[model samples]
Target: MSALSTFANRDELIVGAFAQDLSEVAERGRATLDEEVAATAHPYSITPSSLSHS
Candidate 1:
């Protein structure tokens, strides 16, 4: 039995809490990426960009 399964049959609750935490982390990561993309001028910066060959 998993650690969560031992918690008085609250496995679903435990999983849901973890899922919510992960969702918040992902949202923050996306926001930070947006800020970085907006602040830099380097053509090949860490942010993603469409391909170009000129």
Candidate 2:
């Protein structure tokens, strides 16, 4: 009985840790996407041809 309880607790702990890590990664990904969107929200006055002489 004690062994089963210990195993259950260990499994729960591992699942919790995995969930936390995944949540952190998701949050970081969302933040990165938001930053990219914000950076591209403004339009440049210059044309693509102006940027390149060729």
Candidate 3:
């Protein structure tokens, strides 16, 4: 018997909980990517000289 099965007679709850957690993480990741895309300038845009540290 699996650990979850031992704790809960039904395995569905374990699966459902995991799926919900994964969905939340994916949504946050997508939001972060969207913000990055919006902040970046066009092809000719240049970064400020002082900001370049490399």
C-alpha lDDT score of every prediction, in listed order: 0.80, 0.90, 0.82
Worst 10 residues of 3 by lDDT: 41-50
* TM accuracy, model 3: 0.57
Estimated TM-score for each candidate:
0.59, 0.73, 0.57
RMSD of 2: 6.0
lDDT of 1: 0.80
Query: For candidate 1, lDDT tens digit of each residue in 1-54?
Result: 988667857877888999999999999999999898778757665533354544
Off by over 4 Å in 1: 1-9, 42-54
Q: Give candidate 3's whole-model lDDT.
A: 0.82
Assess the local accuracy of residue 10 in candidate 2 as a C-alpha lDDT between 0 and 100: 97
lDDT (10s digit) by residue, model 3, range 1-54: 988767785667788999999999999999999889768857666658647987
Candidate 1's error at 26, in angstroms?
0.1
Better of 2 and 3 by lDDT: 2
Error of 2 at 3 (Å): 0.4
